[model samples]
Target: MTNYRNETDWERADRNIGELLQELRIAIPGVQVLFAFLLAVPFQQRFAQVTDFQQSVYFATLLLAAASTMLLILPTAFHRLTFRKQQKERMLKLSNRSTIAGLLCLSLALIGATVLVTDFLYGSEATAVVGGASAMAFMVLWLVIPLRARRLG
Candidate 1:
């Protein structure tokens, strides 16, 4: 890289970390809220009436949300542990991977949640259509468009 902005390595790392943290700030709360809701689902009286498939989906979605929460918050922990150790580059690399994986988990969790709700409300017939559509929307909006934009740029 040509250091187009004339920033030192440390400066670049700092900038990247700042940007990543900002992105996480936007994502963290949503995942947290979803995780909270998932945590409470089984406590609801009606939850006992869910089909086996719905139960499976619910568990998987809950796990996905938990994974997303951990991955999304990992950078902060890493930063805290590695602070002042001149590990910004490593932190940045790890944070980038963590963020991507976190977002993937979050997307899948959202899809699962949607499918679960749709199935509960309108049965498997509607769930099939709505779930597929939800998955497609997330994939296109979150993954395809960004990849395409990067390729084009």
Candidate 2:
């Protein structure tokens, strides 16, 4: 097993930052697709016919998707802006924080996608059940699994 305590702080921070970037790579595509779909909804013929509550839900979902996408992408932009500044340690810490923000955004985006799909397919009742389940799963994957892995591994 690797001796984490023996590693320099910068080494540990670099590893953490790398892991975060990998996670964002997985998350970004999904969020982009969702955001694209949300953007197109307003252009659809049936968009105006959607109920007010559904419209509100759709708007909220779109916003969350947008925010998530931004959060996930911010670290890359930040790194580029700070490149050659000898700030790897600071960059790593900021990247990790951005990653946490991105995860929260991702959870919200997933819930929003679930809600948008379910509401379109059935109604609020079914949407609640489906979206709630998806939210729970996101929580487990984003929060529980990582915590457990870090603890056990």
Candidate 3:
């Protein structure tokens, strides 16, 4: 009970939902871009040049992107269907989990796509370096900072 939010249950739920929706808004655009890019890759001429492993990575990344997009979108659908159902608490919790799952899929998708391209253009060594850096970037920006804030706030 850290008094971080001095709101009543309903007020907190409303605020949490608002914050979650805002987070989704910020996340959705980038996910959409990644999703669209992945969708278009198979149509590109260079797509045929990728190795078997690269193709596998491509397919996995594409599926992850699609899943991420759906998970991100599910929150809104959940909200709409349950808006007046007096289940804000349950809805918020589930939506929060969905958002986290969406982010995890999006992170892996981004790393996989980046590694695939790097492996194609550079090699496996460069792909490893780039993949590590990209994962660290997400781990820091998306995860560490929030955790630090939670601890310090």
True-structure RMSD, every candidate: 1.1, 2.8, 2.2
List residue ranges in candidate 3 displaced over 4 A.
1-6
Listed per model in order, the count of residue pairs whose N, CA or C atoms clash below 3 Å is: 0, 0, 0
Which regions in candidate 2 have their CA more than 4 angstroms from the true location? 1-17
lDDT of 2 by residue, 4-122 (tens): 47777667767777887788888889888888988998999988778887788888888888888888888899889987887887777777777788779878877877787788879
Score every model by TM-score: 0.97, 0.85, 0.91
Ranking by lDDT: 1, 3, 2
Instruction: Count clashing residue pairs in model 3.
Output: 0
The numbered model that scores best in TM-score is 1
Deviation in Å, model 2, residue 100 alpha carbon: 1.6
Is candidate 1 or 3 superior in TM-score? 1
Report the C-alpha lDDT of model 3 over 28-141, residue by residue, as the tens digit: 999999999999999999888989999999999999999999999998888798878998999888898999999999999999999999999999999999999999999999
Candidate 2 worst ten-residue window by lDDT:
1-10
lDDT of 2: 0.82
lDDT of 3: 0.92
RMSD to the native, candidate 2?
2.8
Better candidate by TM-score, 1 or 2: 1
Model 1's C-alpha root-mean-square deviation from the true structure amounts to 1.1
Alpha-carbon local distance difference test for all models: 0.96, 0.82, 0.92
